[model samples]
Target: MFAWFKRKFAKSEAAPAQQERHFMRNRTGARMFAAARQDRLGTAWGGTPLTADEIVDRNQVVLVARSREQSANNDYGRSFLRMCRQNIVGPKGVMLQAQSMTARGKLDNAANQAIEDSWLEWGKRQNCDVTGRRSWRAIQNNCITSAAKDGEFMVRLVFGADGGPWGFALQVLDPQRCPIDLNDQRPRTGAFIRQGIEFNRYGRPLAYYFTTTDESEAGYHWGGKSYVRIPAEEIIHGFLEDMVGQKRGLPWMATALFRMRQLGAMEEAAIIKARTGANQMGFIEWDDGFGPETKEKDDEELTIESEPGEWRVLPSGARVKESNPQYPTGEYAPFYKQALRGMAAGFGVLYNNLASDLEGVNFSSIRQGTLDEREHWKDLQEWLIESLIEPVFEAWLPRALLAGLIKVKGKPLPAERLDQYRVVEWQARRWQWIDPRADVNSAVEAKNNMLTSPGKLIREQGQDPQTVWQESARDVAAMIEAYKSEGIDEATAKELVLLSMGRPQPKVAPTGGNTNEAA
Candidate 1:
């Protein structure tokens, strides 16, 4: 039975190793490929295939319309087409143009005018949807006149349905005369030489290709005879949406997870410290009221009163039947009644006296000093953690562990066990001291110990202890200094020190010298 139990435990231990090997062999390759693709495409490349929603989220469509006041050209048309193709479809997508230009002739003037008029009408109809207007003749006229005289024109329109402005289309009118070099290798023609109206099926004035001539020569014309058609289709549905969604969500998720884990760790640490009798001190307001004191009335003084019917004669002159009357002293009057009346008469004098003391004691001014001190301490702590401790551990520990030179026994050492690791003692009149005798030592001693330890018996021959100590110490000091600057507490500093000490050290090179020479 014992043998079976041992075998079961052994199998369980080996499971992770087997799983790791499988993950390295199978998942690594795919993940690497995806990462590379993402880098190339400027998008997320998770191993899993992209979804439609992701594509849509990533898509960014931008429609850039220029008025006729702006110069028009064939390049605009070409750019529009290129933008659409790259964004809407992958590079392999196809593009098609519906041709609508006829050969120019003397009798074709009226026909040309009719075609132009028809195109303009179509533009007007579509303008409401595309340009948010009823008319855009001025803008279209620039492209048309330029196309007619220059024999080419182009404009830009961006599609942001996918991860980018994906889809694009270029409308080249009078293809026979106004052919555009798709490669952009040729010079653009003059604006007056090319003139022809171009539009998206949706009525957006994509561009206008036209050529202008003297009234004697002819106006621009468009017909079946002067144009050729190309047809193509490409699809990258929801690509943009997916890209945007992933880009926005993944980093946020990563950051949130990291922060939550960090906060949880801190909470755990705080709980453990509290259990172990660690006292955390903070300031609390002491409200021992120091305002004015009130006193109660003592005994009332006796008063003698004389009734209307009986008059009291002077004791020495006239004597009647002996009777005593009490006279009131009025000692039970409300406290501060006279003082309040006096104050009301001369309130400005009291105000001036109080104002002198409170001249500089506004709300903001009162708290500024305390706020500044708190901020300074906070900044110091941040510097210590981020600049000092984090860098050294992140940089050094992994290498050490990978080399079989260090080990972490638990996720976080218990607060009670902390003293067993290191002691950071602060003196009233001197700098802090970190004791080296505990489990945690200075970077130098730790490195030297690691180099000469049993794990590197084969690698050790004539290593320099002093050099190792110096290097290690420098590294450790850098980390400690950073933490100190950031305002990390003594306990955290000690933990960081231990963590640093546990990092791996490289084997020292041999040096030729006297046998008794100190490293």
Candidate 2:
């Protein structure tokens, strides 16, 4: 009785395991594997629950093998044995043998057909998604298979406007992960049944796989069938933002200097003068016939003045012939010529002064210690020439000459005809005397040299050169006074002290050879 009870319990225990294994042989095992592969690939699945069509196709096949002893005991066992030998290879003594050859061939054909159809449908879906969204365009012809052990899948992708390619691929062996129901009516029921006849639980199935590249090498590969989580729109937005953030061109200091030079040239030129003089006068003669006095009185006055040996002329006897002493014939001098010359000279001085002042201001502003100081000074110099120097020369020089303030040699030309002289000697001489470069150089050098000397120290210490010279003069005066008081004659005392001080007046060298040689 105890043996029977134990045997019955053992049979019941074996029933569930046997049933689960049979369920795997149908469709559950294959669907589970596909679901696992999908999980590995990371593709998104729609909200719809898992269906049998997504997990296992009706054409899919699974083969099982039976033992030889079981095959010998029943007809069903023999058929099952034959089917296993033709497809699934059974474990045997010293060798393994396929049980169902025809079933294996049919399963192989169905697998190949399923893979091809899936790949075609995937391509169509990808094109529709990329093109419809308008973020991607025309696909390139290059398609490649993955090197992974999972079901091999191929991919074709499109190139961007800048010629970079992007797309997705499926891995046929690994497959994608999917959700499934436990009941028979469910789309893919075999996968859940493989876990046993537990009605309350569901199973995840492995279906189509999506992948870009090997996980370890994904980021290293670009312009391939690798799919990035970021959308193309976000990338383009970032690029445009960066472009808008940049700046262009030179700074305000340089621009302002350039514009000032351009506009000030003409105005500056209208003020420079070459030479100035003040003594030109015009002489005018008047006709006595048109004088206020009558002609008879003018003739009488002429007759009296014509008498010889008489310095004084007698008054005319008749009042009509009387000469009025205060009355005189003359012409008034015009002051316009002198005034014009003075104005021209004033303009020349003004132009020169303005140029000098601007140069000095620029020099003072530039720091000598700075590396760019030389360049800054050069720019300022160019500005001075264009805005101040050249303009003054072109416009003011001519106006000065026209106004008669500028003269040729020492002679002043009339304002109306000042341009007659091709070369104005006096103006040229003045310009040579006031040479801007030589004057500025001499002044700069003198100032620099003066700053380092004992004379400079004395001045800074509050002593004056004029005061020292004056004190020396006073000492000589005192020595003269002492000599005169002591009756030591002034000339002798002066000579004695002058000799003591070694103050002999310098004698001019007679010629070149008379000067002492350094030897």
Tell me, by TM-score, which candidate is best: 1
lDDT of 1 at 200: 41
- Candidate 1 on 132-248: residue-level lDDT in tens? 332333323323333222222232222222112112211222222322211111134311211122334332333433232112424434342343222111110110112432211
The alpha-carbon deviation from the true structure for residue 38 of candidate 2, after best TM-score superposition, in angstroms, is 37
How does model 1 score by TM-score? 0.15
Segments of candidate 1 deviating more than 4 angstroms: 32-61, 64-519
C-alpha lDDT values of all predictions: 0.32, 0.31
List, residue by residue over 291-376, the lDDT tens digit for candidate 2. Answer: 33554654432232245665763333322233223211121112322332232232222211212223333442333212232233
RMSD in Å for candidate 1, one decimal? 36.6
Error of 2 at 234 (Å): 57
